[model samples]
Structures are given as C-alpha cells and as structure tokens.
Target: MEVLLSLVVGALVAAAIYLMLSRDLLRFLFGLILISNAANLSIFVSGRLISGAPPLIEKGQDFPVGEVANALPQALVLTAIVIGFGLFAFALVLTLRAYRSLGTLDTDEMRVAEPKDPS
Candidate 1:
C-alpha cells in the first residue's frame, strides 16, 4: 500500500512538472495546482504512513502518543494549500486580464504592448 502511494505520488509529481513546462498560461496554472497537491501527498506519506488515524491526543494518556499520523506535515500542507490557492487565484486573474487585453492566450503573441512613437 505504501509502495502504491509512493508510485502514485511520483507520477503526480512527474505530471505536474511536465505541465509546469508548458507554454500555455492555463496549463501553467493547472501545473501549479497539481504540484501543490503532489507536494501535500508527499508530505502526508512521509510521516509514519498512518491509515485512518486521528490527530487528537487521548484523555489521561501520558505524552499523548498514539498511532496518529504526524500532525506537523498536515499543518504544513494546509498552510501550503492556502498559499497555493491565493497564488492560483492571483494567476488566474492575471491570465484573464492578459487574455482580455491581448485577445490571445499564446505567450509568444502576448508580448508587452508598447506605444508607437512618431518623430
């Protein structure tokens, strides 16, 4: 099961990397989302590989040690997810504006709009 998870995580990371290299803005955005998810999965898998464990401390238990998955990685992943969401939203808006202004999604054709000067 752990091996399967690792394989799936590796594939997702690979696909995310491939998507990130594409030239399309939308593809790039999607790549970022994929990358973020892959990272979260990686973090989750790295810590003890617990299955269906709660992250809460039990009552009257010393040190609160249990078969719980590491909460640190989960917290980190949550933070990363939030940050990634903000970045994705900002990128989406930027892409939309660029599309509206340039009338195209091609990066090659979306060069900076410069003003014409006449002497």
Candidate 2:
C-alpha cells in the first residue's frame, strides 16, 4: 500500500509539472489544480491509511482516536479546493482577455505583442 501510494503521488506530481510547463494558459491552470490535489493526497497518505475506523471520537472517552483519518488533511484539502476554484476562474478570465487581445490561443505569437523598436 505504501508503495502504491508513493507511486500515485509521484505520477500525479510529474503529470502536474508537465502540464504546467505547457504554453497554453488553460493547461497551466489545470496543472496548478492538479498539483494542489496531489499535495493534498500526499499529506493525507502521510497520515497512514486506515479502513473502517470512524473519524470522530466518542464523547467522554479518554482513549486516543482510532486509526482513522486525520481531519487536518481533509480541512486543508477543502481549503485548497476553494482556492483552486478561485484561481481557475481568474485564469479563465485572463485567458479570455488574452485571446481577445491577441486573436489567437497560441502563446508564442502573443509574445510579440508590440513591434521591437530598433531605433
């Protein structure tokens, strides 16, 4: 299980990095989201995997919580999701503006927005 989890995290991180390197803004946005999810998964897995154990502790019970999931990672993931959504929306709007200004989705051509003033 540990090996599998490590492999999965590695794959996700690699793919996310690859996508982020692409010139397309949309792909970059997606890559950012993917990376965030991968990070969340990595943190969750670091806490160890447990099955069939409840997350909440019983009232008045002094015993330590069972080998269930830690809530911190879950909360962090939720926060990341919201942040990702906001970032994606902003990126989409920026992409739209870029498309409107350049009249093309290709990032390379947009680099030459103004003619080089070689006086």
Writing each residue's lDDT as its tens digit, candidate 2 over 1-119 gives 96798899899899999999998877887888888778878877876676746576688976547576566766777887888789778888988998898787667678765787689
Best by TM-score: 1
User: How high is each candidate's TM-score?
Assistant: 0.79, 0.77
Q: Residue 77 lDDT in model 1?
A: 82
- Residue 103 CA error for candidate 2 (Å)? 1.5
The TM-score of predicted model 1 comes to 0.79
Which residue pairs overlap in candidate 2's backbone? none
Candidate 1's residue-wise lDDT over 1-119, tens digit each?
77888898898889988988887878888988988888888887777566747767678866557567677877888898999899899999999999998888777676677555566
Clashing residue pairs in candidate 1 are none
Stretches of model 1 off by over 4 angstroms after superposition: 52-62, 113-119
